[model samples]
Target: MTYKGIAISHTILFLIVAAFSVEPWYFLMLSVAQILFVPLVLKLVLKDDHLIYYFVIPAVIAVSILQITEDSRIDSLLALIYLLFTFIVAMVGFKRFINRGFTNIEEFAIDMGMMYLFIGGLWFVASVLEIDTGFTPILTWLTGIHFHYSSFLLPVFIGFLGRVYKPASYPWLTAIILISPLVVAIGITFSTLLEFISVLLYMIGIYGFIVLAIKVTYKNGYQKSLIVTSFGALGVTILFSLLYATGNAFGIFGVTIDFMLKFHGFFNCLIFAFVGIVGWSIWTPPARYKKLQFPISKITGKGTVGEKILDDYHINKTYMGLVDDMSIFVDKESLPPMISNFYEQTMHYRLFSTVHWHAWFKPFAALYRLFSSRLQQLNLPFTSREMEMTGDIVAIEDGRTNTRAWIRKIETSTIFIALYSIHTRDEKTFMNISLPLPWSSMVGILALQEQDGKLLLTSKSALASDAGIYLAFRGTIFKLPLEEQFLLEEENKILTAKHEMRIFSIPFLTINYRILLK
Candidate 1:
């Protein structure tokens, strides 16, 4: 008999035993069924006398273990014995069938049956174990299908889908396996017969899409763009699902069954599918076109205010330098618009000027004043002319909006500069400047200067108010540096600096610079 035939025979016997539920009678019957398969498998292996003992001795030991073990462990022992017997029988049968070079549907069916029996037997044994199955909690969380046996149903269903569709490539097979958990989770989360039916339909659709994708890929030699686009889409969908789940967990979004039933649970899948199709079209041109060229104009665009802000500070340059050394980094483009808007606002107001003043104003003015007794220490360069007048410089009259007024005060500027030096192959100066501003008031500056280096770029209104100063500063200092770095360049007689500002609700300033060769 073929391996598939042996597998089906074993499955039928196991189901009959399971119907009896690990009783002594069921154990006896299982032993008898396994013994019947052992001799048949041994006879098949005996044709090769050189390996006859190697195969037969193990089978004998397994049979002995099943019959002699009378404890509660006997159920597990019996399951193992059954698996071993079925595997050996199937292996021998498969070898004999392959030698005969069979290519008919019957042989294929037999092979599938054998695989099912092997997997089913192993699953049954695992279910009987008292130790925690790591996946049980996840499965319980997903489907409410608490029965240990039900866990095996998902893999079996997936197997059946694969068998029925007969996918043309490994990627399609992989996708089906990968998406199975998501399908199960959706079904459980929705918790209704209709939702279960919807999951079934979705599986069918996914299987069809995979089959079509595989066909297209085979016809076009595995399009790289399509693969990348598909994976990208899948990634986005997973992220959306995670977000939605988080929202539900926190009682913010209120978990809804309709999301799964009507919209495939998450928005990412549809987005990915659309992208995959578009990417496939781009990667594989029609017959009318001899060659395809991606339009550079379509891929690139004019700089935005946020990009401009990043460019001004040499943020991008710093990023590129650090990216080689660091594993984690942030993308300036991904910053929220509100935050970027605030940064741009801060730049326009020259917050970095205040920062420079905070660092250098007091010490330099004190030293200069000390040398020239005629000079007053308080009359430092760029000190606000209206220092004595301190209240409500800006106000709002609209009744609908909060009637908050900007308050101002002048305090002695203490210059604090700490420097460290390390020997390196090239002489480079790295400077970081920060200033703490009044928590309740907006801060602005008069002017900013870089002594030896050209002002390659200047920030345009970057604002960080009291609410979130730490996050704002860390983000601005760490992320904006890279973009600013890329925008600095020298042309003709003038050195140019470019910067981008991202606004946030906090108090902070960051200035990036690079000196040009004279």
Candidate 2:
């Protein structure tokens, strides 16, 4: 039988088993979530259509075993098996992330959904084992349910929506949703203040999701109705939750646990989980990510070292510029003369730059400076000296990438040996730069933009664009959790540039450069 067929059959068999078991109504309710809802949502979100579907069956059997058995040893063992399956699912998501990098938010949401399943599994195991989670037994079980539906399914549904429609506020709302699960967990465990704040943010994110849902174009009216009802159900549940949180925190308005289970939980499981699953299953969106087709640098080690290194190696030809033609990226008629000349005839210029490390990162930068020269990679100094940067551009024997190695130096020490190339995605050209390391490489894919007589280049980009800083190792490329921007302008008749790097939207480093014609 096909994996999906087998999974459905297994779920049916468990539903029959749960029907006969002497479990409480609440446990039976969880049974439907664990057995039926999880597999359907897993298959929908994953879109794998393979062995991943088979993995769902074992976890289903585990949950079914939990229903009929009272032996703690057996229950714990079964729950642990279920947790193992969730770990495997999380790894699959991590692999997808590595293959695609951080190019699209929808894919990121899907990956996180897959990863969040592990937390649900952990909580399930904790509940089955009766482990102390700083909450009542019933509440602990409810937390497991929260992670399964709210944390896992909610983001996966949002991700599917993002595949078709993302308004301007999508990323910010997505960020809020992505982090809310953990935030809520922390707040409940420690501080009432944090709990109150997280609920409000989570509510905003959900409302924003509902607003975007209204804008999406679905395949059919049935699908649209199901999706709308799904999010709309969530909107009601979230309101109840906000009231509950406020009651617990500030004695404002009280919402009892029993009231939530009847209304909030009932709506979420029946409408949000069930209806949303059926809605997306009717017409699954195509994955927003594809395998990255760009070439990677083959060069390894500390790069060419010592004087006469170029003389010792067979030279193909020296390059006079980073790119052969500025017109490939921009129209020559539109570009400033200095900007055009700097790209096409870069060898005819002299560069002086002053690097500024942000206050928070100075200590780390100082530590890196101690060993950076030995690596001969990005061996930038800690000082803010406007030192001259000298580099020779040599043609690299990379195949279709047509890469050139720019061996740059400051004073006597090597600073950078960047292998520069270019690639096109969605009809836009990107500057591809790779720095070789031991059996690995750090790559930067920068998109180009021209605005008001200046050139802006950045690793941050729109959806489906290959523009990010990535680390490639063992034939796998994954995006670094950081962003970089370079702005070039002819300020007051001299070619000037500002380079900035940010991690989590916070700037940590900046460098200003002045280029002069020789």
Q: Could you say which candidate leads in TM-score? A: 2
Per-model TM-score versus the true fold: 0.22, 0.91
lDDT of 1 by residue, 128-161 (tens): 4433545453232223211111122222222322
- Once superposed on the true structure, which residue ranges of model 2 sit more than 4 Å away at CA? 1-11, 302-316, 360-364, 400-402, 424-429, 491-493
Error of 2 at 288 (Å): 2.1
RMSD (Cα, Å) for all candidates, in order, is 23.0, 2.9
Model 1 clashes, total count: 50
| Candidate 2, position 472, lDDT | 82
Residue pairs in collision within model 2: none
Over all chains combined, what TM-score does candidate 1 have?
0.22
lDDT comparing candidate 1 with the true structure: 0.32
lDDT of 2: 0.82
